[model samples]
Target: MRLEAVGRRYGARGPWVLRGVDLDVPGGQVLRVEGANGSGKSTVLRILAGIDRPTTGRVSGRPRTAYVPERFPPALPFDAHGYLVHLGRVHGLGGRTAARRAERWLECFGIAGYARTPLAQLSKGTCQKVAVAQALVAEPELLVLDEAWTGLDEDARAVLDDAVRARSAAGGTVVFVDHDPRRLAADTTAAHRVQDARLVPVPPDAAGGPRVVIEATGGGVPPAGLAYEPAAPGTLQVTVPAAESDAVLRRLLAAAPPWHIRSVRPAQPPTEPA
Candidate 1:
C-alpha cells in the first residue's frame, strides 16, 4: 500500500496531526512506527488501516486489513468467544469457520478457559488477548497493531511476537507502534518516526535488527550457517536470521527430541565507537 501526500485533521479548521506523509508498505515485511505520546503515530496507523480518512492526499492499493487499537472496549455485550466469532464473520468467514478460528486463537493465547466469560468480567490481559485474537482470526493481508502488547503478560507477549513473525513469513505486512524500544528490533524491515507532523525514516543501526536468542537443553551441534553462543549449562543461544526465522523454527521443532525450542527475539545491535 502507498500513501502520497497524506494529511489529516479533525475539522475544516482543525490543526493537522499528520501532514504531507509519503510511505510505502511493502508486502511480507514488518514496519515499526515511533513517536512520543500524542505525536500523530496513532493517526497514521488509523489512516493506514482505513479506520480514518486523510483530509488531503491519496492512498492506493490497500489490501485486506486488520487492526488492534491501543485501547480496546471491554464493555461490549458479548463474551470473548462471541465477540471473536462476530468479528470473524464480519471479516467474511462462515459461521462454523469463524467459531473454529476463534477457538483456535483463544487457545493459542492461553485463554480458552475464559472463552465464555463476559468481556466486562475478563481481566485486562485477557481482554487484550481477545483483541489480538479477533484480528488474527481473519489472517488479513495487512495487520496494524498500536500498542498491542501493552497489557499482555510475558507468555502472551511471546505469543504475539511469534504471531507477528508468522504473519510476515506468510507474505503479509505488519505495522505496529509500541513504547518499548526493543520491540521487534531485529525483525523490523523498516522503521519510521513521526516528526513535525510528518514521517521520517530511521537509520537501520538506530532501529536495530531482529535478534533472537534461542535456548535448548537437549541439542546436538547448533544448526550450521547459524551463529550460537553458550548461554548457560546445557543451553545455547542461537541467533537466527529474521527472514529465515520461521524456517529455523520449523527445523528446531522437527528435530529429534525437538531441541526444546525456547525463545526467539530481536538481536541487540552493536554500539558504535565514540
Candidate 2:
C-alpha cells in the first residue's frame, strides 16, 4: 500500500497536521513512526489503517487492516473476550474461529481470567491488552499500532513484541508508534519521523544501524528489544546498532551480578559475492 502526497487538517482553515506525506507500506516488514507529542504521527497511522482518509492525496491498494488506537475506550458494553470475538468476525472469521482465537490471545497476554469481566470493569492496562487482542485475533494483513504498548505490563509488552514479529514474519506489514525509541528497534525495517507537518524519512544509520556486537557473560537476561543468542556455556552474544551500544553496555554493567564483558566490536559487514 502507498500514501501519495497525503495531507490532513481539521476545519477548512485549520492549520495542517500533516502535509506532503508519502509512504510505502510493504508486506513482510516493520515500519516505525516517530515524532514528538502531537506532531501528526497518529494522523499518519490513522490514514494508513483506513480509519481516516487523506484530505489532499490518495491511498492505494489498501489491505485487510487492523488498528489499535493510542487511546482505548473501555466503556464498551461487552467483555474482553466478546469484544475480541466481535472484531474477529468483523475481520471475516467464522464464529467458532473467532471464539477460539479470542481465547488464545487472551491466554497469550495472561488475561484469561478476565475474559468474562466487562470492559469497563477492567483496569487501564487490562483494557489496553483487550485493545491489542482485538487487533490480533484475525491475523490482519496490515497492522497499525499507535502507542499500543502503553499501559501494558512487562510480560504483556513482551507478548506484544513477539506478536509484532510474528505478523511480520508471516508476510504481513506492521506499522507502529511508541514513545520508547528502543521498542522494536532491532526489528524495524524502516523508520520515518513527522516534522514540520510533513513526514521525513530517517536514514538507516541515524535511526539505528552500523551494528555493534557484544560478547558477554553472567547477565541472567539480556535487555529488552535487543537481538541476542547463546554463544558459549554461561555466555551470550548480543547485537544492536552502534548508536545504542553504550546504553546496552550500561544496562549490562548495572544489572545485579553484572555481566562480564568478553568483547565489544562492530559487527563485520557482509562480504560481496565473487
Candidate 3:
C-alpha cells in the first residue's frame, strides 16, 4: 500500500497533524513508526489502517486490515469471548469458526478462563489481551498496532511479538508503534519517524535492520549456508537474512520432525567494527 503526499487535519481550518507524508508499506516486511508523544505517529497509523482519511493526497492498494488502537474501550456491552466472536464475524468468518478461533486465541493469551467474563469487569491486562485477540481473528493482510503492548503482561507481550513475526513471515505487512525503543529492534525492515508533521526515513544503522533469531529444539544441524549460534543446550539462534527469512522458515518447517520452533524474535544487530 502507498500513501502519497498525504495530509490530515481535524477540521477544515484546524492545524494539520500530518502533512505531505509519502510512505510505501510493502508486503512481507515489518515497519516501525516512531515519534515523540503528541506527534503524528498515531495519525499515520490511523490513516494506514483506514480508520481515518487524509484531507489531501491519495492512499492506494488498500488490503484487508486489522488495527489495535492505543486506547481500548473496555466498557463495551459484550463478554470477552462474545466480543471476539462478534469481531471475527465482522471480519467475515462463520459463527462457529469465529467462536472457535475466539476461544483458541483466548487460550493462547492465557485469558480463556475469563471467556465468559464481561468486558467491563476484566482487568486492564486482560482487556489488552482481548484487544490484541480481536485484531488477529481474521488473519488480516495488514496489521496495524499503536502501542498495543502497553498494558500486557510479560507472557502476553511475548505472544504479541511472536504474532508480529508470524504475520510478516506469511507475506503480510505489519506496521506498529511501541514506546519501547527495543521492541522488535532488529526485525524492522523499514523505520520512519514522524518529524515536522511529516514522515522521515530512518537509516538501518540508526533504526536497526531486518534480522531475527529463531529458537527451536529437537536437535538438528543448521541449514547449510545459514549463520547461527548455539543459544542454549537444545536451542539454535538462527540469524535470518532480511530477504531470505521466509525461505529459511520454509526449509525448517519442511525438515524431518520439524524442529519445534520455540520462539522467533528480533536479534540484536551485530556490533560494528571500529
Candidate 4:
C-alpha cells in the first residue's frame, strides 16, 4: 500500500493534521506509523481504511482491507460478542459461522466469559478487544490498526501482537498507528514517525527488532518479523540475516510471556550447537 502526498484537515477552519505525507508499505511486512495523539496517525490510518477521506492527495490500496479504529463504532444495545458476530457477518461471515469465529477470538483474548455480556456493560478493555476482533475476524489482505493498544491488558495485547505477526508472515500488508515506541518499532521492516505533520524514518538501528528477553511470564504469541521453529524440547529459535540479534531481543524482552526473551544464547557458536 502506498500514499502519495496525502493530506487531511477537519472542519472548515481547522489546520491540516497530515501534510504532504508519502509512504510505501509492502505486503507480507509491517509498517509502523508513530506519532503523538492528534498527530494524524489515526487520520492516516482512517484514510487508508476508507473510513475517512483525505482532504488531499491519493491513497492506493483501498478495498481489500480491514481497519480497526482507536475507538469502536457504536454498536448500541447488543452484547459484546453479538456485536462482533454482526461485524463478522458484515465483513462476509454468515449466521452460525460468524458466531463461531467471534466466539473463537473472544476466547483467544480471554473474553469468552463475556460473550453474552452487553456492550454497554463491558469494560473499555473488553470493548476494545471486541473492536479489534471485528477487523481481524475476516483476515483481510490489508490490515490497518490505530492506537491498537488502548484499554488492552497484557493478555489481550499479546493476542494482538501474535495476530499482527501472523498476518505479516502470511504475506498480508499491515499499517499500524501507535504512540508507544515499543509497538511502533516492534519487528517491522519499516518504521516511520509522524512529526511536524510529516512522516520521517527513525534511525535504522533504533527502529530495529527486539533486543532482549529476560523472562516470559505467560505463554501467548510472539512478535512479528521473525520465523521461529521448534529447536528442542521446551525451546524455540529465530535467526534474522543482516539484522542484529540484540536489537531484536530488546523488543521481545519488553512484552508479555511470548515476547519475553527467556534467554539469549550466542547468535552463532561452534557448529555442534546447530
Q: Per-residue CA lDDT of candidate 2, range 210-251, in tens?
A: 888999998676644445789988798877787767766766
**What's the true lDDT of residue 24 in model 2?**
84
Whole-structure CA lDDT of model 3: 0.86
Winner on lDDT (1 vs 4): 1
Best by lDDT: 2
| C-alpha local distance difference test of each model | 0.86, 0.89, 0.86, 0.74
Candidate 3 per-residue lDDT over residues 1-274, each given as its tens digit: 9999999999989998999999989898889999999999999999999999999999999899999999999999999999999999999999999999999999999999999999999999899999999999888999999999999998998788778877887888899999987677546778999998989999765633577778777746554334467878877777764544565675567565577788888878769999
Clash number for model 4? 15
Instruction: List runs of model 4 lying over 4 Å from the truth.
Output: 73-75, 184-186, 207-224, 227-274
Q: Candidate 1's residue-wise lDDT over 1-274, tens digit each?
A: 9999999999999898999999999998899999889999999999999999999999999999999998999999999999999999999999999999999999999999999999999999899999999999999999999999999998898888878877887889999999986677546778899988999999865633465656666766554334467888878776755655665665566555567777776777779999
Error of 1 at 253 (Å): 9.2
Which digits, one per residue and each the tens of the lDDT, describe model 4 over residues 42-79? 77788888888878898886547888888875458889
Off by over 4 Å in 2: 207-211, 214-239, 242-274
Error of 2 at 176 (Å): 0.6
Question: Candidates 1 and 2: which is better by lDDT?
Answer: 2
